[model samples]
Target: MERKSQIPRKTHILVISQYFYPETFRINDMASEWVKRGYKVTVLTGIPNYPMGKFFEGYGYRSRRKERWNGMEIIRIPLIPRGNSSVGMVANYLSFAVSGFIWKAMTDIRADLVFTFEVSPMTQALIGCWYKKKYHVPHYLYVTDLWPENVESVTGIHSKAVIYPIQKMVDYVYKNCDRIFTCSQSFIEPISQRGISKARIEFWPQYAEDFYRPVKKEDSLEKPKDEVLNLVFAGSVGYAQGLGILVEAAKILKSENRRVCFHIIGDGRYLPKLQESIKANNLEDSFNLIPRKPAEEIPKYLAWADALLITLSKSDVFSITIPAKTQSCMACGKPILVSADGEVQEIIREADAGLCSDAEDVCGFVDNIKSFMELSTDRRNELASNALHYSETHFNKERLLGRLDEIFKIGA
Candidate 1:
């Protein structure tokens, strides 16, 4: 007699993130991927107000509170919209923690483990700590942004009064979580210094989505008519991106009569300032600021470019971060032009994927661009190939996800 195969029990995971689907965060994909892997995933997040600092259309305080997308359940709680102001952002962060506390107390949702995707406003991790304590389950935190440091970097708050409290909160969350994952290995030491053992922390780098590969430019997409080399910078145009230096570089390139153009795609809080700089410098002809496009459309834009650009502000915290865009640009099979420092520069150098410059180094950035402009077609293609190969070997999505699956299973 043939024996019937037993069905494995689905390990339910409660994911805590302030941002989710429709917000274009990697967490959306991770949650969906977990669902695909036969795990029950439920997201506890806030109303979608991100780079734009407002709620997405059709989503609000009372609208679509609970929903399902890509086989994962979503539970949106009440939180102030992150309006375009520092005070509003603080309120938005605090409100989520308060709302999540209330929801956790009232809701009977069951989960075997808690996973928190921490970008900024590390306060979001507090909910995961609470869930783990209440349910006696493991809590894993993926630290994309280092707290207190990120807060000081973004807010320019150097006072110990402000940072001390935030540091205390960071310590509390770090102490409570069972396993901590950092996006960059550089982050490990800082977290370890917080009294958490290095053995409990792992570096799990971000991976590009499957759709980020090289694609043929569609006929409908208009190609540049000029012979100028185009460098495309895609993703958030925020202050942390250190895009202002590009304006300075464009000025030098324009004065030198270089045949090059910068195409920046995406919108963020820093866009207005960047635009003002471009206009003030009269470099409009040298720069193109395109509106934000869907994630799926980025590859096409990248294909139209001669090289891709990625930058970050000059800060100890920023230096350690390998921006998610770095992986996406590499996966697009294009030569990258990096104007940042630390881990990202190392990645580009190790892969031979592109030129690198220290953060805020205007002359170095321009020199790199000029170097790219002088490269032969074959040389450029070689760099692009290296980038694609590096992405496949080191940042493959399936491989990272499988590793994550093992970690989750063991924790469960």
Candidate 2:
């Protein structure tokens, strides 16, 4: 009975995220693990609507405001859905920030620490900052993307007057938060340049979800019996991804009669444009746009690929960011062909996972694809082996969780 006294007190963690379970964000797994470890985990999130804009089926006007998901108490607030336009996206962000503020103000749920899972819209962190101010609890911002820079890059907005308020919002969150956790090491320098102290920010990389692992391809996972070498690009086909480069590469490959096929999965604002480009190029047979599938099904698709492709637009902000899908592809134990610069390239180089070409470099992309195609089976397998090894060594879920646990326990 005396030994029971040695057990640490539970850390009550309140997670604030615009995205959560059933929508595919890392915070879901993190919060689930927190519950398993005997911590009190509560989530305050917006209604289920992301990427696709429309609310998920059975969860619209009459749904309950609060619910339970994976042993945590979830509080969902009403917010505008993110439609596929810059103006609509801004409205969505503002709606969440406003609704989240009202919910937190009225709710009595107390937390030892408030943690935010930041992506796309940086204004969501504003709620966490407000909670910190009101409750005097430690607010930890987990930044997957940086704002103002990301905002300007994604929207192509060059006017300082338009971006100044967003910059102030970013600066406000940065100054008020107790500590910042970032997914990329490269993010540190950029974040510090915004007048934040390096010591307050920690580099915590993204990990593949539990379901993203190597699985044997069975008869049920059969692909069409074509001699075409399959190269797959998975994830949102948005402007940020610069998938037009892949279309250009496909044209070059077809011109030279390279027996390669590019399969693109997932939807975004650019999917229509990508399809149109493929049609106009008369390369529909070479580039296939498969409809988006659920997260669980992605591993099978990865297993079906000869090589996985990842790319980012040629923007300074994106160069510092490593797409979370990079970790997912590596975890699936497949050879990766990267067409991006900076941190992701550095990772691929360090792991010898596959090959890299400059973003938007169509010829460089074509050359890399041809080079990959020419590799012997043994060489390709070796690269695949290296990718699996690197994922296990660096980006496993357990390692990242343990680090986050330590951070949460600080001054507890």
TM-score of each: 0.97, 0.95
Question: How good is model 2 by TM-score?
Answer: 0.95
Question: Candidate 1 clashing pairs?
Answer: none
Please write out the lDDT profile of model 1 over residues 38-136, one tens digit for every residue: 999999999988888999899998899999899888999999988878999899999999998998888898899999999888999999988888888
Which candidate's TM-score is highest?
1
- Clash pairs for candidate 2: none
Where model 1 places Cα greater than 4 Å from the true spot, the runs are 1-6, 218-222
Question: What tens digits encode model 2's per-residue C-alpha lDDT throughout 1-412?
Answer: 5555577767899899988867777788888989998889989888887767878776765695678878999888888888888878888889999998997789788799999999878888988998888889999999999888898888889798989988888989999888999999988987899999999999999998888888676721537337888998989878899898988988888899888888888887888888888899998888777787888788887777889999999999889998999899999889999999889999998999999998999989899998998999999999999999999999978888888788878842
> How much lDDT does each candidate structure score?
0.90, 0.87
- lDDT of model 1 at residue 365? 92
